[model samples]
Target: MDQLAAMATFVRAVDAGSLSAAARAIPSSLTSVSRQISALELHFGTRLLLRTTRQLALTEDGRIFYERARSVLGEMKEIEEALAGNRREPSGRLRVSAPALMGRLLIAPLLGDFLRTFPSLSVDLLLVDRNVDLIEEDVHLALRVGRVADSQLVMRKLGEVQMIHCASPDYLARRGEPQTPSDLAQHDCLVFSDAPGVATWRFGRDAGSGQRVRISGRLWVNSLDALATAADSGTGIVRVPSWQVERQLAEGRLRRLLREHEPAPAPLHALYQPSRLGSAKIRAFVDFLVERWRGSDPLGR
Candidate 1:
C-alpha cells in the first residue's frame, strides 16, 4: 500500500464528508476510495472513520489521527513550497484566525487591499473570541491580542491595544467620576468573566509602581458588547479595550476617566508556526498590519 497516497485519500474523505464525494474529487471509483480507507484502518489497527448513509463521523482515534495527518500534510506542503521557492510568490488558500471584534473592525478592512496586491492568494478568515491552535485547527496564521501563551509559535508584534476606563455622561453626572484607582471602590463597575483581572484592576506606568484596586459590580457577563451597551445606558462605568468604545468616547456618548491610571497597553501579535516563518503569505500580511497600525492608536489619542 502507498502510505502517503492512502493518507491523502483519508484526508480527502474527511474533507468531502463521504466516500462517494471523495471518489468524485479524486476522479476515482468508489471502490478505490473505500480500499484506501480500509488500508489506512488496517495499517493503524483501528477504525479511522464511521460511515452512515447520510454522513461520516470520526471515532476518538480517528479524530486524533486526523489532526496528526493534517499537521503532517501541512509540513509536507511547506517542504515542497520551500524547495520550489514558492515563498517569493505565495499562491494558496491561507487560513487565518483572529479575535471577533478585531477581525471585524481592523483586520477584515485591510484584507481586500492585501488580496488586491497578491492576486495569486486566497484567504479564509475565522473570527471568534477565543484561542485557536494553529496545528490543531489547520489555521495558517492568527491575529492575537494581549499576551500569547503559546511559546512554540513565532509571534510578530503588530501594535498595542489600550484598555480604557470610561462611562456615559449620565453615569458620571449622577455617580461622579473616579479621581484615582482608589476611588473606583466607591463606584459601580461593570464586570466580565475571563477578563485579565476580573476582580482586581491593575494600573501603572510600569510594573514596579503599579496600583492594584479590588472591584465589585452589579453586572457580570462574558460579552464585551453588552457591557459597553450597559455602560452607555448609565448602568455603570466599565474598564475595557478602547476599540469597543472608541466611537462612543469620541461622540460624547462615553467619557474616558482615569486615563493616567490606565494599565499598560496590550500588545497585538500575528502568530504562526515556526515552520511557516518563511511563508510569503504570512510575511506579507504581518508586514501590512505593522505598517497600517504604526503611529496610530486605535483607542483615539
Candidate 2:
C-alpha cells in the first residue's frame, strides 16, 4: 500500500465528511477511497472512522491520528518541495479561490501573464462567492474581500475595495437619483443578497464611526453578475464595488448616486495556510498576485 496516498485519502475523507465527497474531489471512485481508508485501519489494527448510514464520525483514536497524519503529510510535502527547489523552477498545481466577480474581472486577466512567467506551473482557479476551507480543499491561496476575521490563516492586505451606490442612467432618469442615504429609502433598490448583512447597509467616515441603515429592495440576488445585470436593465439601484462598475459609469450605462455617503472600503487580502507558506508554489503565486495588484486599480482606488 502507498501509505502516503492512503494518509492523504483518509485526511480528505475526514475533511469532506464522507468517503464519496473525498473521492469526487480526488477524482477517484468512492469504493477506492473506502478501501484506502480500510487498508490504513487494518495496517494500524484500529478503526479510525465510525461509519454510519447518515454521517461519518471520527473515533477518539481517529481524531488523534488525524492531527498527527496531517502534520506528517505536511512535512513530507515540505521535504519534497524543498528537494524539488534545487531544479530552480516553479512546478506544481496552484489551487486558488476568489470571489466570482473579482475572479472574472481582475484575476482572470492576469492569469495569462502568470502562466507565461512560470511555464511549469498550472493554476486551478475556483471562483465562488462563498468562503472555502483552504486546508480541506488543498487550495494554495485565496483572494478575499471585506474585513477578515481573526483566524490561523496568514493574510496580506493587497488593497481596499471602495463600494458605491449606483444605478443605470435610465432608471435614475425615471426615478431620480438619490442625493443622500435617507433618499435610498424612497427608491427601489437592487440588493446583493449573498453579501453578509444584506438587509442592513453600513457606511461611515471610518471603520468605527458608522451608520447602519435597514434597506428593502425590489430585487435581491446572490451573484454580483446578476446584480450588475439587474442594475443595467434598470431594475433598481445597486451598491457594488467601484472597480466593478467603473466601465459602466464611464460608458454612461450606469451612474453613481449618493457619492457623499460611501461605505467603508472593504479590504482585499491574499490568504494562505501558514504551513504552506514556505512551499515554492504557494509563495510564488502569492507574491505574483500581490505584486500585480498592489497600488493598482483593481478596486478603483
lDDT score of residue 88 within candidate 2 = 71
| Best-matching candidate per TM-score | 1
lDDT for residue 285 in candidate 2, whole number 0-100: 78
Cα lDDT of candidate 2 equals 0.84
Please write out the lDDT profile of model 1 over residues 170-277, one tens digit for every residue: 999999988998998889899876644448778986866899988877788777788899999999988888887978988999999998888888888889888887
Error of 1 at 265 (Å): 1.4
Q: How accurate is candidate 1 locally (lDDT)?
A: 0.85
lDDT of 2 by residue, 49-122 (tens): 99875568999989888987886786577657856764677787788999998998998999999999999999
Candidate 2 contains a number of clashing pairs equal to: 0
lDDT of each: 0.85, 0.84
Give candidate 1's error at residue 63 in angstroms. Answer: 2.9
Separately for all candidates shown, the number of backbone clashes (residues 3 or more apart, or on different chains) is 0, 0
Clashing pairs in model 2, backbone N/Cα/C closer than 3 A: none
Structure candidate 1, residue pairs in collision: none
